[model samples]
Target chain A: AQSVSQHNHHVILSEAASLELGCNYSYGGTVNLFWYVQYPGQHLQLLLKYFSGDPLVKGIKGFEAEFIKSKFSFNLRKPSVQWSDTAEYFCAVNARLLNNYGQNFVFGPGTRLSVLP
Target chain B: DTAVSQTPKYLVTQMGNDKSIKCEQNLGHDTMYWYKQDSKKFLKIMFSYNNKELIINETVPNRFSPKSPDKAHLNLHINSLELGDSAVYFCASSIPLEGRSGNTIYFGEGSWLTVV
Candidate 1:
């Protein structure tokens, strides 16, 4: 039973503020990481994913996540965020082999970000 | 074209009633999954189907069952729903990530289920 923990439940900031959402998973084995965003009244959209690559993975809309294997963390970061970046962000993890079988996704309780104009 | 879609974007029913939600994916993905997003916005996998075969059945209650008629469709049926069953149900599809580039799951808009 792998579980992902997100410490921040809600974050409020103004436009241009730096953003970092912490995501830590309990799995110690090879795993795939993903960050998905859901805008108000919209479906979840992929921001980025880490299969096998550099620790620092860049995603859409100027977002990036660092897969810190030692800490079991893949924290999403953005140097600057716009008002349009306001959305509920989810961190998901899937064991490499289990994912290939059924693609079972275990998502974190989302972090809600609100950016003021 | 919509990659993944779910019918009855919103469903409301009384307790002890039976209801179903239908989902279809146009992405030609071999795997389809059902996920429940609780009120606290926690998402968990309920069931997963690969090419119409049940692959992962989470610890969800037996009252909730998922059926995949074909590779492209997955339907969820709930019998004698309870208030705790109220949540947003998401249908998602993804090709196996192994040896694949940028593997990710694409989710439908979600069906909101409310039990009175």
Candidate 2:
């Protein structure tokens, strides 16, 4: 079974501060990665996704993540963050095959981000 | 338009009671999933249905059953609910499992279940 681990449980940052959230997965085959964010009272929204091709993928709201196969990591990064960026972020991984039921996206314990103004 | 939607945004029920939460998606996707988010915000997949067929059933208890009447609806029914079942349940849908470059899941506003 594939599992996802997020190193940080909570993160606090000031406005305009750079941010990085660590995420690592345990999978040996082809995998699809995603970063999803949920605001205070909103549903989970896709931040970005990495299927194939480039390792670095940019997402909405000025967020980006790099899919490092060697490190088994897909870390979310942003050079500058705003107060509105305060939310819970989750890292997920899924295998390439659909019939592989056990390969469904495995989510990590979300990281609560608090961005101070 | 809402791509995914779930009914009873807030559900407060007593223990041992039976309750059902309805989920619907208008995305014309073939795969729908149910995920539970605990108090600590740990998300886990409970069930997934592909084209009205049961595809993925995690180690979830039998008390929690998923019913998909069609391709767009996937409802969750909890029989004899327990306190541990008190969590936020999210319904999500993605493109058909057969023909897709990547599965991008869209989640609905979760249904917060509080078991007393």
Candidate 3:
């Protein structure tokens, strides 16, 4: 079974401040990582994903995440955040199930980010 | 046009009543899933269907049943709903690559179900 854990429950930052959200996963096999964001009264949208190749994957709205295989972490980062960036962030992992054709998708408890204007 | 869409964006029903949420995907994907998001924003996968066949069942209550009439449509029917069933249900679809976790998953707007 694969599970994801996010470090912060709630985060507050001023505009133009750097942001980093920690995410860790527990899985024994190769995994695909993802970051999804949900604004107020909206559904989850994909922020970025790491399928293969590059360790540092960039996403929309000036966000990026690095896949540190050694640490079992995929941390999301941004050089600066805007008020519009305020939203709930969720980290997810997809691991192919053994003897099954479908993938097992698991999501972490979301981290609410509030950006002060 | 919505790539993935679910019906009844907001549903309010009394306890012990039965309700159904319909989902459709125009993306031509083979895999469809039903996920529940609690008030605390915790997401749990309830069921998944690939090519109209059940693939994953995550220990969800038997009251909640998922039906896939085709690859493009998956419906969730809850029998004798309870207060604990009040949550946002999301419909999602994705395509499988050559054995790797599919590149991306598209999600619906979600159907907010409130059991009174």
Listed per candidate, the RMSD to the true structure in angstroms reads: 1.9, 1.7, 1.0
Give the candidate number with the greatest TM-score: 3
Task: Give model 2's DockQ, 2 decimals.
Answer: 0.60
* CA lDDT scores, all candidates in order: 0.90, 0.91, 0.94
- Sort order, TM-score high to low: 3, 2, 1
lDDT of 1 by residue, B22-89 (tens): 99999999989999988877888889888999988889999998999999999999999999999999
TM-score attained by model 1:
0.93
Order by lDDT, highest first: 3, 2, 1
- At residue B116, what lDDT does model 1 achieve? 96
TM-score between predicted and true chain B, model 1 = 0.96
lDDT of 2 by residue, A73-113 (tens): 99999999999999999999876444554337689898999
TM-score for chain A, candidates 1 onward in order? 0.93, 0.94, 0.97
Pairwise DockQ winner, candidates 1 and 2:
1
Model 3 agreement with the true structure over B1-116: per-residue lDDT tens digits:
99999999999999999999999999999989999999999999999998998999888989999999999999999999999999999999988645653467789999999999
Q: Residue B63 in model 2: shift from native, Å?
A: 1.0
Q: Which stretch of 10 consecutive residues in model 1 chain B shows the poorest summed lDDT?
A: B95-104
